[model samples]
Target: MAVDVEAPGLTPVHRELSRAYVEWLTPQDRQPFRPHVTLMNKATVEEAKAALAELGAGWSAFDSHSPALLLWRYLGGPWESVRRFPFTGRAG
Candidate 1:
């Protein structure tokens, strides 16, 4: 699902983290950073639309905490967790 980096909560940490790693990111990834989490892959258009509709119907903003940063590598169909960097500071 898509996330507003400018929104309240864990976004400030995300924005700061992105800036900290800007040198490693490509131009497209650096500028205009639009944070989002991929929930599904390789789904058909109809299936995606249906899923979006179903999910969005109950979507709402809520407070959350980013206890750790997870690094993942896509291995064909499944993804592999590379590492986890735990957050040592507080965030809303």
Candidate 2:
């Protein structure tokens, strides 16, 4: 399932965070992390298609705040929150 969304003003902050993770994190994923907010997961393909269709031609943007970076461990239950590292809001 896939939906495309944009963070109009966060390109810089995302680059900084991505670099920090790549440098300081012990193990990293090989896939270059593209910053996107997930819209659907664990849903059937048809369901995803229907949901995206329901958005009509397009959708309006909204305001949101990112206060923290969450760390999760998947222990069979899917997500177990291990930590919430609040964003320092510091530029790289």
Candidate 3:
């Protein structure tokens, strides 16, 4: 599932923090950064579109919120492989 930024209660701080975090990343690291929350993984494009359409139709709008920071082990060796950044959020 995709996190809708257009969700009714989104705050400007959310946008700013995302922007700042992206800006702080190196060019290569920046490539994977997109303002989204993934609810499922490894779906084909067609399946993804169908799921998204269903979600949109069901939820006319979404509640505004920021995702909490989550840490996971990188499957591909070191954390640096995924690009490192100084944490910059309340939980950090």
Candidate 4:
């Protein structure tokens, strides 16, 4: 689920936004952010490794767009969607 964040200004914008909530971030979150999308979680090591291998075998570069920003809150066991901020600007 590694991502190459190509969106212009995204990295800088993430840093700027993250700074405001630095006090709440964990040690891992405090480190440099490597943006990625998780396709599967809560899986066994073998299952995850197999899935990754299968996915990588058929993977190809693709272009995708972000239509909105989803704000989520981790409630211990599950994540809750707090808000959605739709991008009104023109897409690249």
Candidate 5:
């Protein structure tokens, strides 16, 4: 699954937090870690498309809400650690 953040005018605190996350990760483990809130994960292209369609149908029904911090962990061979502050907010 792919995620994205749509914060146009980020506060300094948010920016600093993002920077800190990148700095904390090793170079090989770094990607463009943008601040975002992931609502769901779809396994297939069809599933993703269906989810997008549903989101579009009900997009305007929900009120805006402030973002929050989320932490995640990745477990695998030769690499097992926790990733704190994985997301801050969702893209519109």
Candidate 6:
């Protein structure tokens, strides 16, 4: 499965955080930092394309800001939410 890296959502802060995390993992298990939101896993390219097309018809883009980071751990199959790190920066 592959993820499509889009802009705005893939901000500078996220890139930095991803870089830090990838460094902790082996190159075989992890890859160079690529910003994207995972739509689905283990999907065929044709299926993904169809889904993207269908989704785009009714999709509306909106402004967003990263407020927190969620950490999840995979047990055997399902992932469990472990922690959340909220961004705490003063506005100028």
Local distance difference test values of all predictions, in order: 0.71, 0.69, 0.57, 0.77, 0.57, 0.69
Candidate 4 vs candidate 5, lDDT winner: 4
lDDT of 3 by residue, 1-92 (tens): 56734533334545555587775655755463345667667888999889888876876654654454343455566553443444355442
TM-score of 3: 0.41
Residue lDDT tens for model 6, 1-92: 34445665446765666667865765644655566567777888899889988887887656556687788887889999999988677421
Per-residue alpha-carbon lDDT of candidate 5 for residues 6-90, written as tens digits (9 for 90 to 100): 6555555455655777667776446554655566654578877888787767665333544544455556534444544434455
Worst 10 residues of 5 by lDDT: 61-70
Worst 10 residues of 3 by lDDT: 4-13
Candidate numbers sorted by TM-score from highest down: 4, 2, 6, 1, 5, 3
Candidate 5 deviation (Cα RMSD): 7.2
Highest TM-score scorer: 4
List the RMSD of every prediction in angstroms. Answer: 4.0, 3.8, 6.9, 3.3, 7.2, 4.0
| Top-lDDT structure, candidate number | 4
TM-score of every candidate: 0.57, 0.61, 0.41, 0.77, 0.44, 0.60
- Residues 4-76, model 1: lDDT tens digits: 5334545676688787887887676666646666766678888888888998889777766677779887798
Q: Model 4, range 1-92, lDDT digits (tens) per residue? A: 34355676567657876888888888977887777777776888898888889998897777788888899999999899999988777643
Give the distance in Å from residue 36's predicted Cα in candidate 2 to where it truly belongs: 1.6
| Alpha carbon RMSD to native, model 1 | 4.0
TM-score, structure 5 vs. true: 0.44
| lDDT computed for candidate 2 | 0.69
Poorly placed runs, candidate 4 (over 4 Å): 1-5, 90-92
Candidate 1 regions off by >4 Å? 1-31, 90-92
Give the per-residue lDDT of model 2 (tens digit) for 1-92: 54455665466755666677776654444355455677887999899789878875586776677787787887886788899987786743
TM accuracy, model 2: 0.61
